[model samples]
Every structure is written in C-alpha cells, then in structure tokens.
Target: MKTQSRWIGFIAIGMLVLMTVAPAFGAGRPETTATEQVTLRYSWWGGESRHNAFLDVLDMFMEEHPHIRVEAEYGGFSGYRDRLSAQMAANNQPDVFMSGHLPPWDILPWDARKDLSQFDLDLSYYDDTLMATFYAPDGFLIGVPQAGGVGGSYLINATLLDELGLELPSMFWTWDDFAELAQSVYDASGGTVYGALDEAGGVPYANAGPPHFDISYHNTTITNENGLALTADQLRFTYEWWGRLRESGAVSPADITAQADDGANSPIVNRDVAMLPIAMGSFSRFQDNTPDTLVLFPAPAGPNEPFTFGPGMSYQISAHTAHPQEAALLIAFLTNRRETGIRMGTEVGVPASGMYRDLLIEQGLSEAEEAMFELQNWIIANRDVRGDITVHARYNEFRDLVRAEQQAMAFGRQTIDQTVDAVVRHARNLGMNVR
Candidate 1:
C-alpha cells in the first residue's frame, strides 16, 4: 500500500510540473523573455523649452512602460556637436540622440548611427521626400526626421517695419527686392536700424549663384547628398553681392553681423534691423527672444529655383545600443504618436507625420507656428528639386575653409575673386570634385 501511495504521489507531482511548463513550450520553442528592467540614455541639444518638453514626453513614456527608464542629456547647441562626436568615437554615446538637420563632418565617417529599419517601426507615416533626408550613403535609415519645413526663410520683425512705416515685401519677392527693401528701411530709419542681416551663410547658396543657374552650394545628386557644387564664377557672384550689401549699409556691417550671430545680439532680436532671413526652424526661438511680434515670409527667390532643404532636424539611434527595440519604440513615440506631437507642438520643427500635422491643426497653433506650417506647405509645392543636403565626410573641411575666406571678404580682407579662387582650390585639395 505504501509503495502504491508513492507511485500515485509521483504521478500527481509530474502532472503538476507538466501543467506549469506546457504553456511555455506550446509554440514548439521557449520564448525569449525581456529583461525585468532596462534603462536607456537619450541626448539632444536645444533651448530650455525643447529640453523640458522632451523630458515630459520621456516621463510619460516611462510611466506607460513600467519596466523601462530613460535618462536624458540635453543642452544648448554650443560645443554639443563636438561632445557628441567625441562620445561616438569612444563608443559611449547615448542610446539615441539628436542628429543635426545635416550630419556634421566629424561624425560622417564613423558609421556610428544604427540602421533603424532593422527594427520593427511603422515608417509608413512619413512621406518619401522627408524620409530621404535622413538616409546614409549606404542607403540605411540612419536617422528619423523630427520636423519638416522650408528651412530657409526670412523672419521679419513686421511690427518694427509697421512702426517705421515700411511696407512689407510680398511672399514672392526676389533677392534684388530683398536688397532694395533693406536699403529702404536703412535710409528711412536714418541709420537707426539696418535693413537686413546678410543671410548668405544661413541659406546654402544665398550669396553664391542663383539655383536657376543649375548650381548649388552642395551636391544635389539626389535629395540628400552634400558636396561642393559651385564654380568659381558662381562663388564670385555671391561674394560680390554681399560685399555690395555691406558697402551700401543696407545690411549690418561685418562686426555687427559677427555679433548678431549670437542670437541675443541679432539685429532683429535687438530691434536693430527690420528683417532677418532665417530658416523656418528658427522662427519660434527667434520670436521668443524679441519683444516685437515677428512674421514669417517666404525666402526671397533665387534666379533659378525657390528651394531650401526640408525637415529641419533629425534623431538617430546609436549602433551600439543594446536595446534597439526599446530605442525604436521611443523614437516612434516621440515622432509619430499623436499625443506627443500635440504636446511638442512645433517645438523642434513641424512634425514630419502628416497625421501629426493634421492633429496640430485641429488642436490649433500659435500664430508663429501656423506661419511655419504655411511656409512648409508652400515649400513642398514650389521648392527646387532637393539635392543631397546631408553633409559629406569632408563637409567640415569645406565649410571651415570657405567660411574663413568668406569672412575675409566680409571683413574687407579679401576680394571676391580671390575668395572664390581660394575656396575652389581648397575644395579640390580636399578631394572634392569641385571643377
């Protein structure tokens, strides 16, 4: 009887074990389980408002996913690029981070960004043109665009213009119209306010030959390529144009332009100028700094095409991230989810998803934000065929070299022809196929 009881007990215990383990193997293999806890580090560079709003979104994300935690690192743009480059070099960058609207020269060669497409993500929400901006040369989805817009436009201090009895330029004004308007404001104000800030550096080829000439400052081989694309004559034309503006005093002098590079001292922000042409991405931030109400105007048309790079900012995953699935989810939440989009409300740029854009419209936008959306739409319908806007591996060399020579011309140290020749030669030396 005791032996029989032992057999019965063994059978019952075996059945219990089977009951416990059967479900785990029901699909023919044991399923991999997620770690009980995970922590992801994220980083970005922006103003205080952007930093705070991003943190709030992260908080909401963590609350929804109780098993995950996100640590944030964020700050101003100054030195942020260098720091990120160093961290990427050390293989110690955050799990995800903000990528520039165009990739920086230092990080271009490292291939440090992850192939986001490898993960499960719903990219269908983005339009093809917007998607093209963040692709690597290898054709990997290296980064996700956060906002879309006509990147280069003039943000005019309309209130100041009105106060000074200056008529605003139309949305379809040309580059010559821009200069004339600047001169008008300068003369009217009796030198109290410069007419405009020479925005050559703000827009890729503003001072260079017009796009109508089939020229650009960088390669437009496709929507996302970046390279030196100007001939020496084109470069000379741009330099001379700006030199004339400086000589006319319609634009701020070189010393003032240098100071205005600091946003606080910007002619528009300081109420020292009637107009400032900037990318739409800067509309909200610049609006915040000035007491006067500013208005967004279309970028003055070039001789060739009215075009600027679309989508002002992008976010990328680190190739070394151990939690790619989680990182991708976070990116989707920040970029595509309706709630996050509404809360973000054009803080970074216009939301890239059409769905998000519609939601923001439904929710209503501040006047400035609405202006940005309008400009984005107008750009989509009219801008030139966007060439590759992502900076190439040697982009820094080209920018720094050209910038130095350009500044020499701006500050009266170099002639337009000399500056143009120097840029072409330097580009050639860097192996840029600049003919």
Candidate 2:
C-alpha cells in the first residue's frame, strides 16, 4: 500500500514537472498548426535564370519556414503587365508581385496594394534615398526595390571592339565622344556592323535614353508639379541627333533596330550592333546570351550630370492578400537574406541591401558581374545630383506614343518637328499637361 501510494505521488510530481516545461518547449516551436499554415502566391517576370534563382530561393524559404508555403507564378516579361492587370481587375492578384522598373502607381489608385511599412520587414540595410523612390504620395511604402544599381548604362560588345581595333570610350565620355566612337565602330567594321542600336524609340524613361538626357540638358526632370517639364525644342534636339546617327549609319537602320527585343533577337546579342543601352542590372542576362565578352559603360555625359537612380525592379504585396504577414516574410527573405543575394548574384542587378551587396562581393563574382557591381557602387557614390519625375498614371501610354512617333520619324514618315508636335498634342490629349 505504501509502495502504491509512493508510485502515485511520483507520477503526479512528474506530471506537474511536464506541465511546467511543456509551455516552454511549445514556445520554441511555431505557434501555427495545419489549420493556421499560410500559403502565399508570389509572381515575378524574368527569363529562365531569374525564374530558376527565385524558385531555389523560394524552396529555401519554405524549408526554413515549414509553416509557410510559397506558390511561385513566374514567366517571361512578355504580357506579364497585361496579365497582372487582368488579375488585379478580378481581385485575384498574387500575394506578392513584381513591379517592373517603376512603382505600380496606376494600380495604387485602385487601392490594389498594401502599404508595406506596416509589415515587420527589416529595411534598415537599404539606402534611404533609394527607398524614398518607392513611396506613394500619401507616404505609404508601396513597393520595395529588389535590385540596386545605375539603371541607365550602355552595354558594349568588347570583343567586337577589340576585333575591330577600336578602344573603349572613357568612363566620362561625352555625347560627342559617343557619336564619334559609334562612327568609328561602323567605319572600322567596314560597314558589316553598326556602332550602336537606334535607342531613339526605346523606352524613354530609361535614364540612359533621351528623356533623362533632356533632364540633364535642362537641369530638371521631364515632369514637374504642374506637368511636362520638357519643351518641344529640347525634344527636337534629341531626335535630330539620332536622325544624324541613323543617316550616318552610326546606329542600326530602322529595320535592324526594329529587330532588337533585348532577348536572343537583340542586335547586340546577334552581333549586329556594337553597343546598346541597357539597365545595368541586365548585364548578366545579356552576357549569357552571347559568347562574346561584354562590358558596361556609363551613358555618355550630357550638359549636366544625369539622374541615375532606379531600382531595376521592385516587389510589392497585394492589399487583397489574405496573409500579409506571410507575404512580408517572403519579401524579407528574398531581398534581405544573404543566402538569396549570393544565389541571385547580379541576376536582378546588384543587391539593394548593403549587407547583401557586401556579402556577394565577399563570395566572389564573375568578371561581368564584378563590372556591374563596381558600376553600381560608383553610381551610389556619385548619386548626390539626384532628381525625380512625376510619373503619370498613363505613363505607359505616353511612352508607347513616343516610341511609335520615333519609329515613324525613323522610317521617314514624319519630320522631327512634326514628331515633337504630335507628341505634345497627344501627351495633352492623354492628360499629361504637356507644357
């Protein structure tokens, strides 16, 4: 009886001890159960390499966070914007989606995105100036920059230049020098290769292109508080310069330029042109498509130092997401994690986080990647002369209009002055408030 009583007492004491320690052990484990597990849908647009890198990162994220699942919806850049627009309209966008080159200001008016500042993301590693570009007018942190670097740069076919016995241009080469070097490329190549792609009709917002050059020339942004800061004469000068280049064959002809899609069809990749303007972040992808060695160079200097700050891409969470916390966690993992940075290399451009950038440098980089990294660092150091343009909601429409007009001018369907007039007239029609 005494033994039985003692056994009962020991069992009771053990149960009491377990009850005391069980809560502590439980605390160490995730509080979520099967019922509370989160599934986050993440979408991004990229090529095969970017898609693979992000998938690998997502796998790592899931492993570290068993309670969270990330469903990746990724594809090439084509039709991505339209598809995203469709999904957004249906109120079925992913929990997280990529905002290409610029913030999703068009969708923001629809209240389609969450203010990421409310999340528990650790953005301390990002530069304040860079972060400032991603905020909404109401001061919401609408999107986070995924990559950091000079968004405007020229990618040169170094192998072709060497073969043609031409020297690379100086780092601070002027617009005239660019014209001369481009002419030299054509002359030296004996007319087989053009000096540069005709970027006149390309995406104007690219800092390497005309709009930003106009900004540098006028010492102001293309748009201001009132409206279009650029004048018809300013725009005419840019088109006329390209017109001379096209006439001189220093740039690819209209048909050849039209073939450039920045993919396998790109003139630089096909070795049809010796130089092309590109977002510095895309150097690796372009490098991968060709056997020839490529190098990044600063966009030719203008009247004033050009504005060079742009996040190559940004990641924004959907306000409609059922799991904001999980989406935030995925974003934090992708952008701020050292492992992810190493894996991504310069795939998305240089890392936006200083810590990740430093870690990538420490991990060693390819020659091409090292060049991109060095260029990004240089831009960051010289980013004191910064400016901002008021991006209109119909900005894409305006961009398309400019590109079409450029093509029309290139094909001799319209004069530069007429192109400028049409641009101004249509810009106003599109509610751009063109001055």
Candidate 3:
C-alpha cells in the first residue's frame, strides 16, 4: 500500500514537472480556443481600391483562421518610401510589406529590412521563373510574389473588338503578329483611332519618367555581379523592336505617352484607345474605370521568344515583426493560389506558382481572364521573363535617360541607331556595359 502510494506520488511529481515545463515551451498541447490572440499588422502602398481588395482578402483569412487578427494599412504612392524608411528605422516595419524592384530606394535583402525566410513556404508552388528574383545571390527566399502576377498584357477593349469583328487575341502572340493586328485595327478605325495605347506618357513624363513596374532595362544576374546573364544585343533588339513599333504607328506616341505616372488614368478610361498594355493583376482597376470588357494577352514576343519577367510586387515579412511565423503564414496564404482561388487570374496575375496554375484554371475565370491566365502560366513555366534593371543603383536614372533618347528617336530628332549609340555611350559612361 505504501509502495503504491509512493508510485502515485512519483507520477504526480512527473505530471507537475511536465505542466511546469509545458508553459515554458509554449506547450506540446494543441492551442486552446482561449490562447493568446495573435494580431499581425500588414502595410502596403496602393490606391484605395487596391486597399479594399486586400482588406477583403484579409477579412476572408481571418474568417478562415478564426484565431488570428490582422491590421491593415495602405496609402498612395507618394511618400511611401519615406514612411517605410521611418518604419524600418524604428524597427516597427509591418508584419508583411509590399516590395517591388524600384531599387536604391528599396531596402530589400530582408535581413537589412528584417525579412523572414524559414516559412518553408513551399517553393514548389511558384513556377521556377517566378521564384528567381525573390532569391538573392545566396538564394535566400526573402520574399514571394503576392500573386506571381504578370504585367505587359495588352488589355483590349472587348466591345471595340466586337464592333470591328476582330476577336480578342490568343494567349501567345509575337511582336510581328501584334503589329499586323494593330495595323488591321488601325485600318478599320481609320486615322481617327488606333489599335493600341502606349504606357509612354508625354515629355518630361515621356522624356525622364520611370517605365511601368515591369518595364526594365536589365535584371540582376546571380551568375555575375557586374554583367547580366542576358546579352546586350538582345536588349538592343528589344529597343529596336519598340522603335519599329513606335515608328510604324502600330503603337503611337499619343496613347502610351499620355500619362507620365498615371499611365492607366489617361485616355484609355475615356475610350480614346482600343488596347492598353498593363499588368494582368491590375486589370480589375482598369475594368472598373471603363465600360468595356477587358481581355488580356501576353506581351508581344520578339522574333524568337518572349522575354523574361519580374514581380510587380512581392510579399515580404518584416524581420522586425514580433510574429514572423504568423506573418509568413499570411503571405503564404495570399501567394498560394490553391487556397484563395485568386491566382487563377481574376484576382491576381496568371499563375507564377507551378503547383497552383492549374488551380487558377480550376477557379473558373471568365474567358478574358482565362486567356491571360494561360499566357502567364506559359511564361512562368517557360521562363520567358524580361527580368529587371534593379541591380544597378543608377538603373533608374539610366532608364530615364534611355527613355529621353527613345523619345527623341520617336519624335524624329534622333535616328534609332543614333539614339541607341547615345544610350550606349551614356550607360558606358556611367560605368556600365553597353554592347
């Protein structure tokens, strides 16, 4: 009887020890309904409409998770950098933040910005192409594409195309094909209208402004620090192709060059043009602005293949966040197309997630959305990326200079070769390579 009592006492002591240790270790027990509430703060820069959409998603996440709480903050583009810098300095950056490639200004590297990498955020979901940029030279997956979104898809006025009996284009189209179709649309609409709108806004806007987020002069090469993985001759051909389009009137200076920064806010909404080149994910905003049904097609490829692409935005967890795991969870949730039905092309861009592209098709997007989804899927799977010029600190300044040279070429002040030479000289003079 005494022995039994001692064993019971020993067991009680063990249980007590475990109970004591459990609280210290956060416990091996399942989280209770009464566990501490986790609140994560997320901030991004976008228009009010974008804020609304993201909030809706956040709400949906909260509903699904039940225990987690989210605080969202968003604002316009102006002063975003200054505000974020302040946040970083204070070690109070949002749990998750919107990241893009407009660098020198951007504090990426996640370590510097306090980003998280060990979320085991399944890389298999994102297409290999989409994952490349998020990883730096050492292969730290600091961020992930919010939607693996594709940009540069031509958003055509479906009603205009219907009126003209021209079908909205297929997912894959080469530049030559684009020119032919634009010419046809031009002939049908006459000199009074044209087939497509350009992202090129007017001068000083045209001469010295930044290109759309996806428009890039070059991308970082993990292979080499100074030189890019792509050829300068290829980049030259890309510029030459743009020049040809500009010169041939397949794409005119008027539509593309109308809004320096407000590229979407211009004539396209007023129905002044038939097609506007924009990011696939941003189509929702453009669609909301106009009465026309907008369909997406891949960016016009070159004579050989479509170029590579980079992210318009990336979802990065702040290193400073108290809830790194929770923050990464939210990012993973947004990026995982299978969960939200967003990557399926309607909510975000086409699938950059290899595991998730089919899920997008499964979500039953509209015909217009479907085609765009397929195009981006192809790009992601195939690695046809235009990449970015984010590596060079002066890429932006150089790009603005290049834009001026291109505008001069378009305005007939400088010939294509002359402009190219000037651009090469300028880039080389800036301690860069210009083949």
Candidate 4:
C-alpha cells in the first residue's frame, strides 16, 4: 500500500513540474487568438502624397485585422539611409522598411534583410524577371518589388511639346533621333525653352545615357562580373555625347541645369524644359506641380537594345522582428493586395503583381499613370534583367567625382580625354575594378 501511494505521489510531482515548465517554454500552449495585440513598425521615405497613401493602406490593414497596430516611421529621402543604418546598428530597425531593389543601397546586402522565402507571402502574380531582381546572393527572395520598381522614362510636357509644334518621339526612338528632336525644339523655341534637362550635369549620368543600363564601354555591360568593365574611350563617348547637347543648346549648361532640383523650381514643372528624363513613378509629382498634360514614354534606346529598366523598390522585413508573422502579413497587404496598389497608384510605382496591375488598369488611371504602367509592362516584356555589379559603398561618391569631371568637360574646362582619365583614376582610387 505504501509503495502504491509513493508512485502516485511521484506522478503528481512530475505533472506539476511539467505544468511549471510548460508556461516558461511556451510548449504545448494554445496559439494566440486574433484578439491578441500585435504591433509592427514600418518605415519609408517619400513625399506627402506617398505618406498619406501609406497611412490609408495601414488604416485599411488595421480595419481588416483589428488586433494589429502599425507604428509609422517616414520622412524625406535625405539622410534616410543613415537613419536606417543607425537603427539597424542599434538592433531596432523597423519591422517593415522601404528597400531599394538596385545595388549598392542600404538593403541590397544579403544580411541586411530576412530571407522571405520562409514566409507565406503570395508572389505568384509577379513577373519572373521582375521577381528575380529582389533575390539575394543565395537566390532567396528578400523583398517584393514596390509598385513595379519604377523605371526611367522621358517625362514629356505634352503641353509644351504641342505648343512648340514638335511631335513626341516614338517609344523605340534611337539616341541620334532624340538628339535631332531636342535640337529642333531648341531651334524652334529660339533658345528660350530647352529641349531637355542636362541629365549628365546634375542628374545621375547612368540614367542620362540611353536605356541600356548594362552597356559597358566596349561591351554589352558597363560592369562585368569581375569589376568595372568600361574603357576610357567608352567613358569619353558619354562625356562627348552630353557635350554635344550643350554645344547645340539642346540642353542647358552645367551651371544653369544645376538649379533644377524639382518641385516648383524644376524646369519641367516650370515649363522651361519640354522634356525631362526621370523615373516613371515620379510623374505624379511633376503633374501635380502643373496643370500641363505630362506623358511618360520608354527612354530612347541605345545603339544595341533597350537598357533602361524598373529597378523597383520593396518592403523588406527585418530578420530581428519579434512579430515576423504580422510583418509578413503587412507586407502582403502592401505589396500583393490589388486594393492597396489601386489606393497607392503610381505613388509607389506600378503594381508589382500582374493581378494588381491588371486590377489597377481596369479601375482606370490618369494619362500620366497609364503611361507609367505601360512603360513598366514594356520593360518586363522587353528589358533584360541584367546581373548586378557589386559596387563599393563609395559608389555614389565615385559618381559625384565623375559628374564633376563631366561638368568640367561640358563647360570646356576639361577635355574629353582628361575627363575620362580623371574618372578612371578616381574609380580605381576608390578600389573599384575599373578596366
């Protein structure tokens, strides 16, 4: 009888122990219900319209899932990278953050974002080539393209072009053709209104060239798998191309072009320039600035093929998030939901999902928005998803150095050969594998 009683006592103790340990380990516990509170932090950089649109989407998300609360962190693009880096260093990065799809940005590193393949997010409606751009070095998708990753376009002031009596160029127009049209606009406007912005002067020169983003000096790509693949002669061609525009008054001089920083001061918004080379997603801002009808068309092609592309943005989740499931759900709502895309419009970019894009199209879009969507579609159908060039952290610095030299060449302060030499030397000094 005593042995039986002792065995029963032992079993009771074991059960008590398990009950005590179960709460601590959270093992075999019932899952939290939808009524449980889940708060997530999301950050992005954009203007007021983007901010409002995001808030509206977040509001809708909260309404549908009442238990999840989202904290908003947003601001202008300036210092955004620095802020994100600081937050990450402190291990307090936002659960969801805006990440650039292009290389050498804050979130491009494999380690910077979580491998989202483990999540249950739906990406079936996205284009394969467009989807591939967001993959990490290990082929794990780290983010979903925002809008459709806005590509470069010729943001034409149709009103200005009409007033000038110049027809808009075809989507597949060549660089030589673009130059002729620009010259015609210049001559017809009697030099008061310029043909286009000197995209080489202040704007990034990569976008200034024809749409082929991968073109190198003597090769098909500017940067190869090993390193910088451009030659001095190829670099010279870029400078001389822009210099000719300055010579013909097709574009403004460096000093004059430097003042066009967008908003009310932008040459496009002010109607001082007939066309501007810019990303397709930014059309709304230019349109909002003026009542003039604006249209977006594919960038002029290079000598070989189309190179301009939608280097899209994405909503990347942090690996350190305490609410991974909630964060993933939020990302799905923002990136995959057709309603969210419709609400955001081109504020983010064209919708990344094919279904979302189709839905947005059916809902009807402004002329500018329609043009952006068409351009994105064309890019997906036509442009090659070139492999990324591993640029150093000082990539932008090198670009600035080259820009200064290009401006010097444009102003006749430096020769084209001198400009090329300076750029190559500067790039090499930055530890870039320039050819």
Ranked by lDDT from best down, the candidates are 2, 4, 1, 3
Using TM-score as the yardstick, the better of models 1 and 3 is: 1
Q: How close to the true structure is residue 153 of candidate 3, measured as C-alpha lDDT? A: 60
User: In candidate 1, which residue ranges exceed 4 Å CA deviation?
Assistant: 1-33, 101-110, 136-139, 200-227, 385-387, 390-392, 428-431
lDDT of 4 by residue, 159-233 (tens): 888888989888777677778888888998998888888766645424322224235223343333344556777
lDDT of 3 by residue, 1-71 (tens): 99999999999999999998874663233322424578777888777556776887888888877778998
Cand. 2 TM to true fold: 0.84
Best-to-worst TM-score order: 2, 4, 1, 3
Error of model 2, residue 35, in angstroms: 6.9
Which digits, one per residue and each the tens of the lDDT, describe model 1 over residues 228-340? 66666656666677678778878877666655653666678887778776657778878878788888887677555555655646778887787777788799888878779
For model 3, the stretches where C-alpha displacement exceeds 4 angstroms are 1-40, 56-71, 77-92, 101-107, 113-115, 120-129, 165-170, 198-248, 254-256, 260-264, 310-312, 329-371, 381-390, 413-418, 425-430
Task: Pick the lDDT winner.
Answer: 2
Clashing pairs in 4: 149-312, 211-307, 211-308, 212-307, 213-307, 214-221, 215-222, 216-221, 216-222
Worst 10 residues of 3 by lDDT: 206-215
RMSD of each: 10.2, 10.9, 11.6, 9.0
Error (Å) of candidate 3 at residue 382 is 5.4
lDDT of each: 0.70, 0.76, 0.59, 0.72
